[model samples]
Target: MVISSDSQRDLFSDTGALGFVQILLAEMHDDLLGKVARFRQLTDLSKTLGPGGTMIHGGEVAYTAWTEARNSFIHGNYIATVMLCQSLAENLLAAYIDTDLEAEKLPKRVSFNDTIRRCVSKGVFDKSFSGELITMMNIRNPLSHYRDLEDPSNLSRRVLDSRLPAIAHLMGDASFALAIAIKLLSLPPFWLSGETLK
Candidate 1:
């Protein structure tokens, strides 16, 4: 799929925002301002990637919904915002499964990273792609389950650094985790092909 690099607005990195979570949440909702359009973009990708008639998981759609609700939460949409955290968690895994089905041949059972690795092992993606997916998938757990925001060592940064080199500026932030999550879905399988995953 041909995607426009400029389609996603850089809300957190460009706005000079202070709070990572608050700013990112706000940016997702500010479609008119063009601060960032990650929610819209990811949703579109999820649909496009599943064009083959396979049933895409609700979790994938929920994750995109959580991203949208996060913005609404900032604007006092309490009902929607209250549930985004958990919804996002479910979505992440769902999206992973959707990616699994995209493969020409799929394994019977595997985790999100392993599923991606299987694709790489088939020469669909290079070994480095598996490593990156593993790192990002590993990080998603802490990001989804953690409660304290004060701690600087969060998984989102590690995942982002693995994908987007520019995110190195804020490697300890959890809010950007969603951005990384969506980024994982955005990348094409072709870009990751070449090396063995092991």
Candidate 2:
């Protein structure tokens, strides 16, 4: 059967409820496809610098955790992502420091603060970078612990409220945490040999 021009035009026109619904669904599908494409790009970027290439001990685990943390942040799990990034920084710093210390001489356990101090003392990181890492830790600790507090009036909870301004502040802190994590991972002194550094 030969379809008339008017019939073909009517088929694609968004003039009725059904047409509106169909148009909405098509727009939603396009948006989802765009998101999926972006997600794939991020995943590829995350794997660009592999753990082995970084050369820190336990680098593999830390790199994997970083990728997961990045995914979490992209997926809107900001608080969890910040916490994971902070943990990754700690692990990377510890492993980097342990590289220079004898196995027997290493501490049984070290806190993040102690690890940062050791890194600074060993020249793995300078005082300024050490201070930045400490600041990131400070931001992560309060946010992470605030979720576990039982008291509704806790200072951390009050400061990190659900309001827009508070959320923006948390996002800023998370960005700093991620930036510090990446800096620690890619620091030339940590990854380079003596000859390379010189």
Candidate 3:
């Protein structure tokens, strides 16, 4: 059954849905007492960000991006995972550069690329790491915007439009996206900066 995009199906689709879910749950149940999961770092941001009252408003985006990105990865929404990771990195850099590290308005017309450049200039991240951030943008670019199929760098052609299988490419890219998010979230300046600038 193909549900149309406009369709609004109830969460409880049918009476048997609950029974099916219960069976699936039992199948997935793990008896292990301890299992270190890869999803932990990508799940929370408020703890890392600290006492609330952002550098500017809307810092909460970073929190949501992490959760959604993790969900996207685990659910096989690889494209969304890649895109959200890039967005998370950009927002973090913007937070650091917004209003001289104070709770002031972010400057006007600062592009995402410029936000990264500013972070490097302010010594927020070294020149080497600047390339890492840029790499995030590059990976996300094809997903975010249209790319010519003739171009060798077009990710859609490489991942979706191909006659051959591209699942491995997509899975690898999503994993790489998570790795980038983990590194950015773990950065001292980002996690320790908190909401206030002192």
- The number of the candidate with the highest TM-score is 3
- lDDT per residue, candidate 1, 1-198, as tens digits? 755657555422563446777878775566453323433543554453322322213445664665565465334343333244335434444354456645554345434555555556656457775565555444444544673444443434544546644233223222333344334444453133335569
lDDT measured at residue 99 in model 1 versus the true structure, 0 to 100: 68
lDDT of 2 by residue, 1-198 (tens): 999988899778548998889888886576476456546644554443434455545567777778777776655466777788887987877877777645324576889888877877877779999889878877776665654545543335555565446656666666677677767766765453324434
Tell me which of candidates 1 and 2 scores higher on lDDT: 2
Ranking by lDDT: 2, 3, 1
- lDDT, candidates in the order shown: 0.45, 0.69, 0.67
Identify the runs in model 3 with alpha carbons over 4 angstroms from their true place. 1-58, 99-105, 159-164, 193-198
Clashing pairs in 2: none
Q: State how far residue 84 of model 1 sits from its true place (Å).
A: 8.5
Highest-scoring model, lDDT? 2
RMSD of each: 16.7, 11.9, 7.2
